[model samples]
Every structure is written in C-alpha cells, then in structure tokens.
Target chain A: QQQVKQSPQSLIVQKGGISIINCAYENTAFDYFPWYQQFPGKGPALLIAIRPDVSEKKEGRFTISFNKSAKQFSLHIMDSQPGDSATYFCAAITGNQFYFGTGTSLTVIP
Target chain B: SQTIHQWPATLVQPVGSPLSLECTVEGTSNPNLYWYRQAAGRGLQLLFYSVGIGQISSEVPQNLSASRPQDRQFILSSKKLLLSDSGFYLCAWSMLAGFYNEQFFGPGTRLTVL
Candidate 1:
C-alpha cells in the first residue's frame, strides 16, 4: 500500500507543553521520512526528517521518533508556543514517489 | 536558494472549460518534478512526476494530464474540466543528485469549478 495515515486530525496544547503527532505507512520500501510544517496560506516547509536506520532525530524543538518495526513515525514538539500553531504533514519517500499523511492541525494556546 | 513557483494564484472555471496550470523551478537543474492536489484541510495527493524532459509518470488517473516540455517546466492540463476537478494545486521539486528526496513545494493554486 502507498498510504501514510496520520492520526488526531486536530490537537490543542498549552504553552510550554509538548505536542505529539503520529503517522504510519504500509509500504515498507520507504526509507526516507520527513515532516513538514505549514502556515495559513503558505506552502508547507520542511521541518525535520529521519532515516529508517535511526530511531529518532531532533532539530531544535522538533523531533522525529521513528519505529522501523512498526512502520510508524511521529513528530514531537518540545515546549510548544502559540506561534507553532499550524498544520503538520508527514511524508514517506521511496525513490521518486512520495506518499503523504492526511495532516494534523495543532494549536498552542498561550 | 532554490524556489518553485505556480501561476495564477487562484482560478475559477466552468465545468466544460479547458484548464492549464504552469509550474517552474529556479536555481536547480535537472531536478525531479511533481504535481499534487489537495482538498480543503486534507493531505497532498500525488498526481504525476517527471524525471526528465518529456518523461512523465502519473500516479492517479482522473480528468487530468501532465507534461514536462523543458527541464524546469511542468504543466497540468485538462481538455475539459469536471466539477470535481477543482482543488488546490501544488508543484514541487527535489534534487536527483543522490538519495536525498526532500521535496520543496510552491505557493499553490486554488481552482474552483462552478
């Protein structure tokens, strides 16, 4: 299958709280996984990415926890702020094709 | 830096109208190109991809088609658009130099069919 399913269509977090979003894919051929962050009326920007060879990768306050055995990955935000409110997307790439998750809208209330 | 662009930020068409959307990339040569469509609050759906000039592989079959005439130009066209052919169109590109496949997206085009 080429589907990358994401969970929690929407989430609400408070200031200084951690926000988590999950995604799972069926195609095992995928080796590159990347998460994207998008603001209102703008294109999605690359956030953080990880390879299946590693279980986790962190960039500043954003981290990707990847599980090879479960064919799943997740994005975790540390000490989320109100400006972090936006839609996030997870994508799986094979060679030239990419499969994307449904996306998650996150809101951080101050 | 590299940038991807899509034309006519927004469009509205009738059901029987023909459609054409343009996408171009700057600062990159021989990059892999892609076309995607997204519904309101939904994820991006891959429509087609091109590896080189005149080479196109479609992932979904609907009332749409794609073409790559030059190295950095990709176009999405339909002879006759249907009511369901309206959505947010995005163009993206990634370097084919190696295994790195992080795609960069464009501002996106909103199409409304009435």
Candidate 2:
C-alpha cells in the first residue's frame, strides 16, 4: 500500500510561471516531510523540508506549504526556470525508514 | 563533513551472474545505513537497512541481500542475478537508528542485468 499519494504524475509549466506539486500522506506518525529533486543520472538532492509544526517553509524561490490537519504538503516553485525541470519527490520519514510518494516529473518550457 | 561513496557508477552483468555493490561512509560512526532500488518509472523502494555492524533488516522479499560487514560499510550482494533486479541502486545513511531523520545519499550505482 502506498502510504503517501502525490497528484499530477507529471507537470509542464512555462518559464516565469509557477509550478506546483502536491502530496498527501496517511501516516499520522510521520513528522518530518522533505522534498527531493533528482535529475537524470544523478542522486536525488534535498530541496526543502518542513515539519508539521510549521505551516510553510521557504528557501529562496522554493516554498513548502504544509497542512497538518489535511495531512497534505505541496511544493511551489516561483519564477520557474528551465533548469528547475526535474523529478520531485515528496517523502515522509517515520523512525529510520522513509516512505516516498510515487514522484512527479516537472518540465519548465523555455 | 560526511561523505558517502558508492562504486562502479555503472555495471552490466548477464543473468545468473553474481553481483556485489559496495557503499561506505566517512566521518560518521554507527550510522543507520539503507539500500534503496529505483526501477524504471517507479519510486524509490527500500530493500534493506542496518543500524549497526553485522545487523541487517530486509524490507522486501527478493533475491537481494544486504550485509554490514563492518562499521560504516554496507554491501548488497546477489548469489544469482535476475533480470528484474536491474535498476538504479542508492545508498543512504542517517545519524541514528530512529527518527533524527536526515538521510545523506551516495552518488548511486546503476546496474543492468542483461
């Protein structure tokens, strides 16, 4: 069973526009939520993370909007650029194990 | 600073061949190690994890097995490779056994089972 569900298996956005990807989790015990960005032939790197205590956390142009009551979190990329095109994954960590959502492939057209 | 290393950036092996993939971490002691496999068009799948030396916990029932032969060293080995085992393998390490929750990943190894 997939503990976390992510919507819009793939996304396409124009440059200078906003790109949003959302995820929902069923595990209440999951406390830490993180987003990872992965490109072809490379490891997934940490992009942004947020805890349930905070409603939102932003780093530069990337923002994570978390809804604790709804058990959902979303990533919003501002001024989307072609370089930002990559696979974004939402993960929930419980104990030492991490449960990952399927993944969303984002494409920013130039 | 911590560094995680995974060798043989890419491998091509025929079916029924033995396989070995190695991962090591530097500058950390007794880290929680993990092995994850990513198949085509699929999310990362946890295969095994270890909290200490000589300890391993398998998350899935498969032809692969993991071992922590020494501290900071984790190995994934298969007695005989299966075509379904072909995928991108990643190694990750966290500070402790439980939820202190940041995992640093290695560059990853791509294995092709022909």
Q: Model 2 chain B: which ten-residue window has the lowest total lDDT?
A: B95-104
lDDT of each: 0.92, 0.91
Cα lDDT tens digits, model 1, B1-109, are 8889999799999999999999999998999999999888878888999999999999898989999999999999999999888889999999856767799999999
Q: What residue runs in model 1 are displaced by over 4 Å at the alpha carbon?
A: none
Query: Candidate 2 DockQ score?
Result: 0.74
- Report lDDT (Cα) of residue A76, candidate 1: 98
Q: How many backbone clashes does candidate 2 have?
A: 0
Rate residue B107 of model 1 by lDDT: 96
**TM-score of each candidate structure, all chains considered together:** 0.94, 0.96
Which RMSD values do the candidates have, in order?
Answer: 1.5, 1.4
Q: What's the alpha carbon RMSD for model 2?
A: 1.4
DockQ of each model against the real complex?
Answer: 0.79, 0.74
By DockQ, the best candidate is 1
Q: Which CAPRI level is candidate 2? A: medium
